[model samples]
Target: MIKDIIANTTNIKLTVIIRRALQGVASNNNPYLTLILQDNTGIINARLWDVSATDIEALVAGQVVTISANSLLYNNELQLKINDYQVLSGKEAEKHYQNLVISAPINVEKEWKDLLKTVEDFDDAILKKVVLHLLKQNEKDFTTRPAAVRMHHNVRSGLLWHTATMLKTAKEIVKVYHDREINQDLLYAGVIMHDFGKIWELSSQLITNFTLQGNMQGHIVLGSEQIGLACRTLKINEQEPIILLLQHLVLASHGKYEFGSPVLPKVLEAEILHQLDNLDAKITIIDDALKPLNSGMATNRLLALEGRIFYKHEGEKKKK
Candidate 1:
């Protein structure tokens, strides 16, 4: 199974059909192929050598193809080396592999309505407008964008799920310190809009990838620029209330320089938002990493999640 290919060191002997070909150029070389193939278990990465000149042209993105690959470790991660592959252009491949992808099983419309209801609870009009505008701009992405490329919340509507959870947590904390005069408007806006820039920063295909903007300026600068445009178009007085309300203490959500935040969390609400966002993201990483099994032991090497090792926690046993 494809899951075994990712989990163990056994040579990949399974039959998988290529579902998508991600466009990428090797360092100082011509464009190579990064094929995303799928079996009943999950998707696996298959690297094709010299694909630029081969009949790989027929195997376009979303085209299923038969492949024979050897699994090996690259950069301490499992990767498949495609020895031979062919495009299955006829209707046979579709009937064989259409049910392999494990996508979101919940009702998308219900989740969206629930998200809107959560936002309506906030009593700040300016913050509400900012969020509404962002939602309007990415009506499709908010519901379809993955929270990450390959880590926690990397599913349909995953970004919205994470954002809604953070808002809920922020509300509870903000209520505890009622006298801080902490601008709930700004904090709420920042929490919702912080990663909204990623919608543009990432390519929203089946495989989420960093766009040119993401590779160059990264999400923080891109997000800040987007905020600037929104503020300008809406004619919000950004110098005083708008900047104070919209600006995050740490420019990036991570709260540190290395993680991409231009400014560290300094303001009261910005700091709080940073912590809340971090807490939610990390917990999600652990949750997703441990979701597959029910017992024994498993150590997940989460590169995108945190480049760290994670061990699943066994539930408590009943005392009879």
Candidate 2:
């Protein structure tokens, strides 16, 4: 398995899925291929030196392949130095493909049911209808797609896990702010709709990648467009206060223009939704980075977290 391959390993032969493949030019102007490979356990980068055009054509993304390589530490990260590789065929490829796709470590059906219930519990009719409509329409993809290509919650059913955790967190936050002027239903709807476009933005395949729409429009713009369509189908008035506010939540979920948000959060609900979204993503990244480390050890710099290193406290108790 990918997790068991470390710096000391040699003469490694494994069946793995090609997550990504990119062609590059070496210093001497020779063509090479850089591949991101994955199994059910984890992902790693591999370099194939002095590659020909025929080799590049054969190494397609999302295909299963058998490879010979050696593990080595490069810049404090483990990478593979590939000597040779071949795309698998027949029963061997099929068998490896079935086992190589990683998924969320939770019961997807249960989490999906919980998500439906959360939407159903919304007291505002408009909010409830909007959220439920989108979920039901995209349920299959929403329940199975990854939240990202290489960031936090990038595994299968990861979108659901990310949504479920955010919903739970939002519910608690609403209770604390209940005494204030906070609109609980708007918050609920906002939380549910924030990443709704990801269903179309990301592929649900074992090796996830961006769709054409994802690269062109992005999740924030795409999600806002989805909300608008749902509103129109439901006969939601364009002039209604909720319409613009809900769209704002989706548009501003990323919190800033530099972060891909078209606009910064103006309303209180949008601000809260953005904060909660960021908080959950950051926590998940840290948790994932610390998983393989012993207590008191610091994880390698996480690229997603702007190259930040996190430490696992020795005295901190872990959940079962």
Candidate 3:
């Protein structure tokens, strides 16, 4: 049985397939493969011990190979010292290596249906029509697109999943700011189409890689272009289309220049979209990082979701 390196202790033999091999230096002189081994539950880092030229030649990234290693904690993080390793060549590799990734735990179809219900709750016809068109245009891709290349919700059906969450939050905010003339239509449009560019930005597999277009134009540019084209095809009113398109711009840009936005959010709706998106992304990072920790104990450290460290919620511990 495959065991997670995270829970493995000394002398515990684990049968895990090496998933990724990252090169790094050890002890300032030795080269090592900082590997990531995965099973069904989770992935953890492992250190390939006693690296030699011959050993390095036998393994390659993405190959399913058996590893014998001893687990140890370094700086409060779990890691394994690989003792012996070999690539499972041919059929064995094919049987163990899974390239396609679609999370089965989450009920994507049910979640999408519920999301549509939330969209239907909106009384505005124009906003609904715009959303319907965008969704229809990219329905196939959206259903299977990962939200990002490696960050939050990077799984099949992730684009829809993230969009649905953002929409639900935006709905609550709309009710609060209804009288402010915040343009609910634009707000909803922004929420639905904000990250649609991600469909092209990332590879749609268990291991996502950046595409040429993704590297050349990035999501913000690609997403904006897509919205522009959809707007023209629908022949939406010029002013309304501009506002709707700006909604996606706000989401794509997030806030500052460093965060990959060409321009910062200037409008009230745009500012709100940035804040909501930031909040959701940060929370997701913290939540996913802390999943391996025991219920009551605090985690050692978080690698900062958006360049900032996060402390676990104290309230969750009390309740537990």
lDDT of 3: 0.68
How far in Å is the alpha carbon of 30 misplaced in model 2? 4.4
lDDT scores for all predictions?
Answer: 0.69, 0.87, 0.68
Pairs of colliding residues, candidate 3:
none
RMSD of each: 5.7, 2.2, 3.5
Candidate 3 structure quality by residue, lDDT tens digits, 259-320: 78887886777777788888877777777666655555555555554355444554665433
Q: Among these predicted structures, which one has the highest TM-score? A: 2
Better of 2 and 3 by TM-score: 2
Question: Against the correct fold, how does model 3 do in TM-score?
Answer: 0.82
Model 1 has a clash total of 0
- Candidate with more favorable, higher lDDT: 1 or 2: 2
TM-score for each prediction?
0.71, 0.91, 0.82
After superposing all C-alphas onto the true structure, candidate 3 shows an RMSD in angstroms of 3.5
TM-score, model 1 to reference: 0.71
Which candidate wins on lDDT? 2
Query: What TM-score does structure 2 among the candidates reach?
Result: 0.91
Point out where model 2 deviates above 4 Å.
Answer: 26-30, 90-92, 294-297, 312-320
Error (Å) of candidate 2 at residue 18 is 0.8
Better of 1 and 3 by TM-score: 3
